[model samples]
Target chain A: MRILVCVKRVPAPGAKINITADGRAVDTAHLGFTTSPHEECAVEEAVQIAEAHGGEVTVLTLGPAEAEEQLRYAASVGAHSLVLVPIEEVDWDPQRTAAALTATISGIEAAEGAFDLLLFGNESADAGGFQVGVRVAHALGRPIVNGIKGIDVGDGSVTARREIDGGFEVYEVPTPAVLGVKEGINLPRYPTMKGRLASKKAALVTIEQSTEAGGQLRERLHRPVEQVSETVILGEGPEAAAAVVDVLEELGVLA
Target chain B: MTMLVLCDHDRGTLADASLEALTFGRDLAAAAGVSCEAVVIGKGAEGAVGQLAAYGAAVVHLASHDVLTDFGPEAWGETLAQLVASCGASVVTACGTDRGNEVLAQLAARLDEPFVANCREVDPSGDTWSLTRVQWGGSLLEDATLTADHKIVSVAHHVVEAAPASEPAAGTVAAFSPDLDASLARTVVTDRVVLSRGITLSTAPVVVGGGRGVGSAEAFAPLEELAAELGGVVGCSRAVTNNGWRPHSDQVGQTGTRIAPQVYIASGISGAIQHWVGAMASKHILAINTDREANIVTRADWAVIADLHKVIPAITEEIRRRRG
Candidate 1:
């Protein structure tokens, strides 16, 4: 089984963010960048699938030069190879991003043999667009079972459990497919220093871009506007309860 | 006549977000001076054809194959590609919801068309789209233009309230049985279960979600109770799933689920971008986080700096007492 995990580098979602001075996009001055939260889970899923199935796991991405940091991170996570679509920057929207990714995946399929399993985070944690994996599947005209919470693959097929409305939907799909994993699909392991060191020799492949129709990448992104509301603590202990009661009573609830 | 909208359905029930997308589609179609029709897939949706027509669909194309019951992105893309080619749509529309977005993304790539997902609106210009979309977890809004022959846009969820046309036409229902090679496809649907009564997270007017800060799965009782009282669904954070407190299905985030409720009440969770992406399309966001400056507070319409342990119980009690 050769597994391909699509990974993205996004501003560390845990960091504070603001739009840049141009009001075009998120301010990166105080931000730290890392493997997108869900993509990290994808990388983990890929490596685990490889470990379990006895095959190689390759990491694929599209980004600027500094994005190589993510390839090293993928190595630490146990990826066997890295394919980076070299670009100063890539499209911001899911549509164009999907195109870039589809191009990269096609290039890989042409070089390496067809991938057995393709994994991605349910969606990029920051971009928040759950379009790529399915788009890639569509682009390649391959089967895709997505938003999988539990997966069982053996023999010649893939079985997965996904959450539906109130309960779970269990599915079975053949191999040579795509699976978009949500968090809790599996807990990702922290990269060990040894793994990181060994990852130094992993391969990174880059590709040039074709003209994209949408100029969705030009505009900057910013944080949502802050909304304000008034807050007043009631008081302490018994008095607080009394005041709270009075307030509730005044609102015609406890009266 | 000019647009084809792919309606996302499971079995027979239309995805609620699709209705919201229909609102955008109708508006976009009107702007383009073209009529819009829909292609409905999946089984068990016998009654949905009427609703699709009610939502301004001129015709409802139904393809009720057994394999179509389960969502295979490849087969779906193939189906929609054929639909577009045969139907002669200049544009294809779907909701930015997961399934619709996925199918359209694939369709666009297959057709070599440009698309933008989660676009708030699209101003159609001849053969292009001037689009606006939310970025960085609803922290930013930006505008762009797509120059493509086929302008496909995934309308943002819950951004536009759904209002069907008055005096809906009894849309002509056509049997669309496309050829699909099941052997070549990878996934098959085995079983499915739907929530019994609670409002769907994607379609709910109100959502009450608990995070790890809520402490335990046992803690969800009050939140669930309140969500019920509010006529909403109970949602969980990624931690809730990781801790084995809740199934991963209820986790809301990038890896979890994307939802657009009218009113969202988040309890005890630090608003990580992953978490925020799930429910930020809400009309109103009320965050009750212990941290006064939690990221959720910044994005919320109303922020309450209090422990959910205290607030959830008190609020539930108030609801119970008031019901009396």
Candidate 2:
């Protein structure tokens, strides 16, 4: 029941995202870095599954060397091992990233035994390409599904639940499957002091690799034009309540 | 060379989002001087051909395999991949729904091509299509280039309105049977569970959205009361969900649910770009916050500079009084 989870280091953006002067990447000077929210939950889910099933959870990340911090964070929260595929660039297109991961995973599997399951965030919070997991799974010749919330492991198979409009759709894939986990799958645990100390002493594994840029190439990044609205102040505090009602009535939401 | 659009449907009814894809495909095809076609896969796909025609699909490919009776990413992607090859499609597009992105991603992976999701604009004037796509939800835009033999892209949802063509196309229906192996059904939907039934946050006409200022889970009571009075629902920001004050299901943000209610009552929310992308689609927005300079207040159509604890309850009482 070995599980591998992939996480990406992204800037924890504030109210606005400031692009670099070159317009190619996000300005990180004023921002702090953290793994995407959904990936946090994915790491938590993997650790929980391994804890229950008597296996080890290996956390993998593909980013700059600083991403080792994210891998260590995963270790602090119960991951048994860490793997970092370090890259020099700010980001790679989905295809290139998936290719690098597929090759690295194959090499890892050849060295050790194959993992039973591979987990990824539904999409990276910043790029939101929504395809890396699917691409990697296909390249590795495994069954995969995205937007999964609940996962139940069983003998030789795993049952997953994907949220939809009304309820959820269920899918059961065999061992050696891939799943793109969404947030809310679990509330990730906070790192304890003991866990932090252990994580600091844990061994760090780094894989250096680079792949040719894929077809999708970034030209620049820019902000979308903001919709300027002249807000009409109805009133102040509780006194404005009647004015709000009038506006709602005018909008026809109320009679 | 043809532009192939994948139309999504629920049972026999066509999804509104697919209409947007159709519109985008039609325009791109016209610009490229190529035929625009559509593919609707799964059961009841025939039901959408007429509407697809009205939206300017020159040919509607009805694809069905024994394994495609239900939604499966691999099966559907295989179907689309076969269609792309058979139709000689130069570009493939779909609405950026969960299923749309998933199926097309599978197709891209099978073909080993680059697929861009949530694209606002794509220029096919050159050998490589230049694209402006939504990143970080709709808050930031990325200018990119897609160089592939067959470009695959998904139009961003809610970015464009679905409209019918002034003059409809022939919309000739062609039955398609893709070669699918039984193994593709491994990821097919095995069953379904209906958790709760009713208006959801995305479909609600009125959404009372609360943020960190809501204080606690119990503090959402005033917002709930206000929403119930207006026959709406209560929504929360990612901050609230992160704080464990509300479930992620109730969150209105890029990572949560992208809501397009008629009127959104956002309270105690600073309106970060991530949250704004989800709420910006609302027809009207009213911000209730103590900070006059909050991002949500400045962007909202109307603002009530006050605490939501006082404003929300008062708004509810006023509605009750008027009804009486």
RMSD of each: 4.1, 1.1
Model 1 segments more than 4 A misplaced: A14-16, A22-25, A90-112, A128-130, A139-141, A201-255, B43-46, B64-70, B166-170, B182-185, B193-208, B211-247, B258-265, B281-305, B314-324
| Candidate 1 Cα lDDT to native | 0.72
Tell me the tens digit of each residue's lDDT in model 2 across A70-126.
998999999988989988889988999999898888888999989999999999999
Q: Residue A225 in candidate 2 has what lDDT?
A: 85
- TM-score for model 2? 0.98
Clashing pairs in model 2, backbone N/Cα/C closer than 3 A:
none
lDDT per residue for candidate 2 within B1-324, as digits (tens), equals: 798999988666888899999999899898877899999998887778889999999999999889997889999999999988997888899999999999999999999999999999988888888999999988889999989998899999998889999999999999999999999999999999987688889889999999999899999999998998888999999889888999888888878888999999999999997788889899999999999999999999999999889989999999999999
Off by over 4 Å in 2: none
TM-score of chain A of each: 0.87, 0.98
True contacts kept of 1: 0.45
DockQ of 2: 0.85
Reference-based lDDT, residue A208, model 1 = 71
